[model samples]
Every structure is written in C-alpha cells, then in structure tokens.
Target: MRMTALSAVLALSVTAAAQSQPAAQALLDQGKWQEAASAGAALNTSAGLTLAAEATTAGASLVPDNQKKALFQKAQDYASAAIAKDRSNADAYFELARAQGRLAQFVGVFQSLGLAKDVKANLDKALELNPKMAGGYVALGLWNATLDSGGLKGAIAVQATGASRSNVAPNFEKAISLEPNTPIHRIEYANALLLQGKKAEAAAQLDKAVAMPAVTFWEKRDLEQAKATLAKLR
Candidate 1:
C-alpha cells in the first residue's frame, strides 16, 4: 500500500513537471522568450524543447543568417522532443513551423518556399486544434504571404505574400478588431495598406500604432521602420 501511494505521487509529480514545460512554451509563442526560459529552467528534454522552439521563433525575424541558423537549431531540438512526447500534439506542429520558418530565412528564396510549406502544414494543424488561435492564423498568413503562394504573382511576390500587403489586410484588420491591444496586427494592416498602394493610409495606421498606449518598445521600433519605408515611398 505504501509503495502504491509513493508510485502515485511520483506519477503526479512527473505529470506536473511535463505540464510546466508546455506552459513555458505557450509564453514563448507569444514572444515571451525570457519568461519561457525562466519557466523551463528546471525541466528536462521536453521542457528544453519548448524553450528551443520559442527561441527559434524569436530568431527567424532577424536579418542575420548566423543568428537565424542558431535559433533554428534550438527550435528543431525542442520540436523533435515535443513530437517524441506526443506524436499528435498540435502545439508541436507550431514549434516545427517556427523552426522551419527560421531555417528558411537562412536559406535562399527557393529553399524558403519549401520551409513555408512546412509552416503552413503545422499552422494548419494548430488551427484545426483551436480555430480561434489568432497567432496561428497570423503566422500562417504571414508564411503564405512571404512565399507568394497566397495571391502572389510575380515581381512583387515577396511583398505580396509576406506583408500580405493587399491580400490579407482584411484578415489583420479583423484580428486587430478581435484583440485591439495587439500592435502587431495593426502593423500588418498598415503593411497591407502600403501594398495596396495607399501610402498615406499606411502611414496613418503606423502613426496610430506607434501612439497606442499599449504598444511595446519593439512594436514602436517596427512602426518606425514602417515610417521610414513610407517616407521613401512618399
């Protein structure tokens, strides 16, 4: 009887430990890498995988290949672990999408196309699990836009697919309406306006995003970049 009680306690403890790793991963998904690192510090391989996946997602947006490559490796490690833990875990798909996206950024445009497809597959699975996950939709849309696979045609494919400048503007607008405080959504809408050849309208949205009381410092930086781009257009 005592052995049975001890075994039950051990099982509960292991479950709790495993659960926290995924929780850390959730924080990472929302661009909270530091928080995720803190949450996952004492965990095992699965937890480390969560941390690595978050790191990869954060790294892919960078302009440097070295940085992107490192992050992709980290994300790959965690995503593999996650898949090992639960083959059907939808969140693992999101991590894999992030990893592939980072790796694609490091590779050339042609390679990026394949990575974009992987991102779509994982993101599609994620949405299947939770249709209301705004981030997943945004990520998928961004991936599709980047590859010019969704409404992308020719010379302007990069802008059309990634910025979803004209094609997915309404989606970002809808996402913003759903969550007013998220500055990234507004920025996406601003980009869409620019893609639609509405420079002035895009600038206005950027200004509004920059002025938002809830805007983060990073978001403000993105707004400034948008302003610079718009200035060149004007």
Candidate 2:
C-alpha cells in the first residue's frame, strides 16, 4: 500500500511539471523574462530548462553591454542543463547556439572567433534534429554574416571555421521561406545585408519588417529595432 501511494504521488508530480510548462511560456511570451526564468528553473524537465535558457538569452538583449555576458553565460548553463536532461531536445541545442553567439560578443577576437565552432555545431545539431526549424536557418545566416564582417580577421576565421559568406543569402532565404510572416527573419536578413554594405537591400527588408504585425514581445522588439535601423539608413 505504501509503495503504491508513493508511485501515485510521483506520477502526479510529473504531471504537474508538464502542466507548468505553458505557464512559464506565457510569462515568456509577455516578456516577463525574470518571472519566466524563475518559473522555468523551478521545474525539472528539459522543456522547462530550455524555457529558462531562452528567457535568460532574451533578457540579455535589453540589458547593458557590461551586464550581457553574464546573462548569456547563465543562459548557456541553462541550455546545457536542458541538453543533459534530454539530448534530443532540438530547442535546447538551438538555445545553446543562441547563448554562445551572445557570449561571443563579450570576448576577445580569437575567443569570439573560436566560439564559431560551438555555435555552428549546436545549430547544426538543432537543424539535424529538426530539419524544418526556420530559426536555425536564421541563426546560420547570422553566423555566416557576422563572421564574414570581420574584414581580414573574418577571412582568417572563415578559413578556420569553414563559415562562408556564400552561405548567408541561401540560409536567410530558406528562413524567410519557412517563416514568411516572421518579422525577425526579415530584420535579421537586413542586418546581414547591412554587414555586406548593401544599404539599399537592407532598407528594403527593414521596410517590410516594420510593416509586419508583431504578436509577441520578441517580434515587437525586432519591429522597433528595424524601425531604428531603417531611420539610420534614410
């Protein structure tokens, strides 16, 4: 009787953990980053940990540069934990890549360039696990574009990491095709174009991105960023 009762309690706990996921996501959708992170950290599952990582990384965007590296590292830790919980969680790998990209910004030239391997590997694994993940393609596009923007250093890094600007347009186009209505994809593509000094093309993409309807906090943030970037071009 005692064993059966304990098993029943364990099942209920598992069910509650699963049920808590959407609540955390609701906070994330509303841009309540801290709340979402806290809620996610309280749960034991990979999905919950992934949410915490996403929230931390997203929060890093709104912070000062001095503060961003720590947040990105925290997000990376959360993502790694999520992967430990479930290796097949595609989003965990994707979140790891995202955190790595942000963390790269806080390091020196060689260190930042070195991170390309980790970023690319996680992104590749994410896409391999879920071939149709548009965000993975968007990240790949950005990876190529950012690395190629480094001038001579970029060339060396490109050779070292095997990341080519040749891949940027195709990856971005794939992301745009997969998620045509996602403003972030358009905004990211414009960013890549700007890196290549294609001001006119960047402006066109920004125009389209700003005109799109934004339903989530992240989308709205991207829409505002697009507007700011376009204003600079004009």
Candidate 3:
C-alpha cells in the first residue's frame, strides 16, 4: 500500500511538471531566453532546471562579451542543480559543457585547459545518455578545432587537454549525419575548416549554410555570420 501510494504521487508530480513545459518552450521559441529560463526554473524539477540552463546559455550567447561570463556561470549552476536532481539528464550535461567551454575562453591558459577537460567529460556523458544528440557532437568538433588553432597556446592546450585536431572533422561529420538540416552545424564545420586552412572546403560549407532557410533567431544569426564569412572567402 505504501509503495503504491508513493508511485501514484510520483506520477502526479511528473504530469504536473510536464504541464508547464510547453509555455516555457514557447518563450524559448520566441527568443525570450531570460523569461524562458525563469519560467522553466520555476517548476523546480530536473527537466525544468535543465531547460532553464539551456535558456540561460542561449541568453549568454546573445549578450555582450563583458556580460556573458555571468550568464554562463548561471547556466552552469542551473545545469549542476538539474544533474543533482537527476543524474540521467542528458541535456543538463550538454548545457553544462556548453557553458564551461564558453567560459574557458575568458580564463587564464591553465584554467582554460582544465575547463576543457570538464567540457569534454560532460559532452561525453551527454552523448552516452543520448547518442542522437547532434549538438553534443558539434560542440566536440568546436572543442577540438578551437583548442588546436592558436599557435603556441593551441599546442599547449592540446597537450594538456588531450584535444586532437584530427577529431574535428569526424565529430562535425557525425553531427551532420545525425542532423543534416541544422544550418548552424554546417557553419560551425566551415569555421573549423577555416582553422585548418581549408578555405575552399570551408567556403563550400558556408555556401550550404547560406542556402538553408532559417527557422529561428539563432539560425538566422548563424546564417548571417556564414554569409559574411563566405563573402570574405569569395
């Protein structure tokens, strides 16, 4: 009788938690990142917290460089809380990795390299839990490419973090295989190719990205960036 009662309570809680998600998602779809983050976090559930983290990260991306670090830190905190609430939250892991990777750019060399390990570990965990997570693969591709592109700093980071330039193309290829319609992935691939001095190959990717129709504000922004890069290549 006690177990049955507990199960019923859990089911009710889940249903209630799910009820608020659609409205929060609507805010995200509208690009109201800060509002979405707050709305999702209000639910006080793991999924809600993860959504909050995702929104917070998106907000961070749109902010000025001087203002981004705090938002990313907030995202990391939300994602950590979500993971504490539920160990199997794949999106939470991904968001944590995303925030960490972005945060790494603002830190000292040793700190950035250390954060790279955390970023990779979280991305690995996310993919382990949800193998179809194309975004995780894309992030990994950027991780490899970025850590290996900065001359002496790049070399030191690669040696310290075990990041491999060879892994960049494979990761982006896998991401595209899993989610070919996402324009940002191609743009990211182009950026990675440019880092490799494959300007022609990168231009090819930018061309593809330019041809894709934008479905969201973020996609449109990526397309604009790609177009500018393509123009430079031309």
Q: Could you estimate the TM-score for every candidate? A: 0.67, 0.93, 0.91
Ranking of predictions according to TM-score: 2, 3, 1
Candidate 2 wrongly placed segments (more than 4 Å): 1-11
CA lDDT for candidate 2: 0.92
Candidate 3 lDDT over residue span 46-135, tens digit each? 888889998998888787899998988999999999999999999999999998988888888789888999999999999999999999
Tens digits of per-residue lDDT, candidate 1, 102-197, equal 687677766676666667778778778766666666665455445543343434446423433344655565566667776666676666555455
Residue pair clashes in candidate 3: none
Q: Which candidate has the top score in TM-score? A: 2
Error of 1 at 22 (Å): 9.5
What candidate 1 gets wrong by more than 4 Å, as runs, is 11-42, 45-48, 59-64, 149-167, 192-197, 213-234
Q: In each prediction, how many residue pairs overlap at the backbone (N, C-alpha, C within less than 3 A)? A: 6, 0, 0
Candidate 2 lDDT trough over 10 residues, lowest sum? 148-157
Over 87-117, each residue of candidate 2 has an lDDT whose tens digit, in order, gives 9999999999999999998899889877889
What overall lDDT goes with each candidate model?
A: 0.64, 0.92, 0.90
